[model samples]
Target: MRKHHAQQLYDYHVWANDKFFARLKELPEDIYIQEIQSVFPSIAETLVHMYMVDTIWLGVMKGNSMAEIQASIASVQEITKDNQLQKMEKLFQDLSAEYQTFLHHESDLDKEISPEHPQFGRLDTQLSELVQHVVNHGTYHRGNLSAMIRQQGYASVANDYVFYLYEGKAEK
Candidate 1:
């Protein structure tokens, strides 16, 4: 079962992202959106970029039109709202649902997807890798987001996978 391992990883990632963002909301709005020394431009912009790119890659892996994912995110960047916390929740929810559907439909663990990455060139990867990459990608930016927020003097909860495993509901 390739699917089992991949799904397990996906479950862990969804668990981690949800908890991470929930704690992220505790930080003041200004701090969360603030620019500081980060892996990306600003915490806010990077977070948007993370979700957008992830959907693109995931869409490509699942044979979904990457354009839809691109357009969905391009719409958000045009005008980010003040209620960013709500927006983040929506993004997470959508990603969670999409990934869940992907897992269910892709029951074959050995399935392969070869997609060309603009930066990395062509990638011949397992579905497991694609699923894991999105989670890892999001977590990296979430870390960037946390650090950026704290640089402006805001506190954040630890959003690690181990923390989620010990503390939160994982089956949802």
Candidate 2:
């Protein structure tokens, strides 16, 4: 079977996220939880947010109700409350695996899904578009993570999609 565009983008998303997480592991453990005045309170919190949002969207894509998604998010918050780096990394890995399974089985990337929001009203969109949004959202947060790392006087990893392509070529 041919790979869908959404799946390809999701593959890049996973690759970039993994690269960033590995770099985070190389930094001082304390830096992961150091409080910073930015989009999020700390690197740990930011990562947790990313993971939670990813989980929520995955649930949405799976046709889960909002209440179910909220419950799942609450569970994630409890699991990541301590802001431990390893715990957060594990959650991300697990979620990525889940996403992989979902993408593998999904047959209709262009299927329209109507997801209603309390504040934003309703969005009528395709599954592939939602997947793209998730990737874009992650890219934005990774940029925030990069700046936060620099603010802490640490080097950030290069996770650009072009690099992902080049790396694949090199491995070939």
Candidate 3:
């Protein structure tokens, strides 16, 4: 089912993340940190936004309240790259773990779970939808971050999911 693709995407997503961060680290730190993009404002902001969406989506999937989700996002925002790569890796790991858990524990991926999204209002979603949400959301903001790197005169790695799958190995 969708869980198979979800499992594959977990690997792809993390590979892309490692590639993105490697490119970031390769860039001159000052330019990497200073190059500002309107969409994300800064590379740091883009990274934080990715983790925020993770928290938001993961919380909802865990049956946590919107209020609790917001708190999770706030805490994620405080995590700077230097401050928490180990922790970030764990969150990325959890993304895969949680997805697997939901796949097994739930009787059906199509079952509607309508949870109140604080900003989006009522959202009737499937487990599949949440998996899709994180993949699509991560890809979008990672693109923003990649563009920022290119704008700063750096070559960005291929972060497309297809690219990641075809490559079959994480870079760095």
Please, what is the TM-score per model?
0.79, 0.94, 0.78
Query: For model 1, what is the C-alpha lDDT against the true structure?
Result: 0.70
For 1-172, candidate 1 gives per-residue lDDT tens digits of: 2337667767777776676677767666666566676677566677677766766766787765546656765665663554376786787678778878878887684588787655688778787787778778877877776777677777766778777667753543
Which residue segments of model 2 deviate by more than 4 Å? 169-172
Clash counts for all predictions: 0, 0, 0
lDDT of 2: 0.89
Which candidate number has the best lDDT? 2
Q: Name the 10 consecutive residues with the lowest summed lDDT in model 3.
A: 80-89
Lowest-scoring 10 consecutive residues by lDDT in candidate 1? Answer: 74-83
Report clash pairs, candidate 1.
none
Candidate 2 residue lDDT tens string, 49-128: 99989999999999898899989989988888886888777888899999989988998989999998778989999999
Model 3 per-residue lDDT tens digits across residues 43-141: 766776687777677788777887888787677666544534445556666665675576567666556788886577988777667867787888888
Model 2 vs. true fold: TM: 0.94
Off by over 4 Å in 3: 1-3, 80-110, 169-172
Poorly placed runs, candidate 1 (over 4 Å) = 1-3, 65-83, 118-120, 168-172
Judged by lDDT relative to the true structure, which candidate is superior, 2 or 3?
Answer: 2
Distance from true location, Cα of 24 in model 3, Å: 1.8
